[model samples]
Each structure stands twice: as structure tokens, then as C-alpha cells.
Target: MALYEFRCRECGSTFEVDRPMQRSSDPADCPDGHSDTVKLLSTVGLGGRARTATRPVRPPSPFSGGGPPPMGGGGGGCCGGGGCG
Candidate 1:
């Protein structure tokens, strides 16, 4: 079952109705004996528990060499052949 809200154009009254989802689009009679009613848009409220999966831990790769090399390892710079003089 679902709850739907409706507004009566004749009396300018708003009300809620509890009925099956199949009859949601059916015409609704106002409580004040008004027949000119329009179904009002309503927000849906949901409650439940969400689950998350745990990721597996991975070991370090052999190609990484544990960490980066020490600074000033002597390599070609922008001037090439380390000739920055």
C-alpha cells in the first residue's frame, strides 16, 4: 500500500489517502464532499540498512624497489650529459 496526497479544487483542501499502488491514479473524493480533486506530487521516504564490501589488502610490488632512489643520483638534465656549467 502507498500513501497519496490530493487537493480539492472545490474547497481548496488537501488530504492524504492510503490505498494500493494500482489505484494511485484513480480519482479521489475530497473529505468535504468535493469531487474536483487533483493528485498532489509527494516525495518518497525510504529507510533501510546499506551494506559495503571490504577490499582485500595487496602486497608491495617487486618492480617498485621498495621506494625511490636517493637524491642526486647523477642523470642527464635539461642541458644534457649533466653539463649545466
Candidate 2:
């Protein structure tokens, strides 16, 4: 969908219209049924909603044994890399 802004010459009122890009040549009328309208150039719209296709990969945390904790919490052990437990 595409957004377009227009001003009515007959009523001096501004309005917006949504239409497909392929049907751009279609005429727009004012709310009071006036075909005498002017298409206004808008600068604020950023088009339709978009989203990223890929998610970011997060590395394992140190508390899970990926690496040593930043502030040091757990003691080294057999289950956690210490030999005697």
C-alpha cells in the first residue's frame, strides 16, 4: 500500500488516501465529493512496516561454564573443570 496526501481546491481541506502503487493514476476526490483536488508532497511518511529476517546469535554465559565469571562466583570442581571435585 502507498499513502498520498491531497488538498481539495473546492473545500480547501487536506486529506490522505491509501492506494496500490499500480493504481497511482486513479483520481482522488474530497470528502464533500469534489474532484478538484491537488496532490500534496508529504515528507513525514516512512512507508510500511518492515522487519529483519535473521535473529542474532548470543554466546553462552560464563556461569554456564562457557568462561570464567566476570566477578568470580563458583569454585572450580570436577563437574566444572576441577579434577578432584
Instruction: Compare the candidates by TM-score and give the number of the best one.
Output: 1
Model 1 pairs in collision:
none
Q: Single out the weakest 10-residue window by summed lDDT for candidate 1.
A: 61-70
- Report residue 51 deviation for candidate 1 (angstroms): 21
- In model 1, which runs have C-alpha deviations exceeding 4 angstroms? 46-85
lDDT of 2: 0.76
Tens-digit lDDT string for candidate 2 (1-85): 9888889999899998999978766779998899999888776676666657987978766456565534545433335553452
Instruction: Report model 1's TM-score to 2 decimal places.
Output: 0.52
- Backbone clashes in model 2, listed as residue pairs: 77-82
Each model's lDDT: 0.76, 0.76
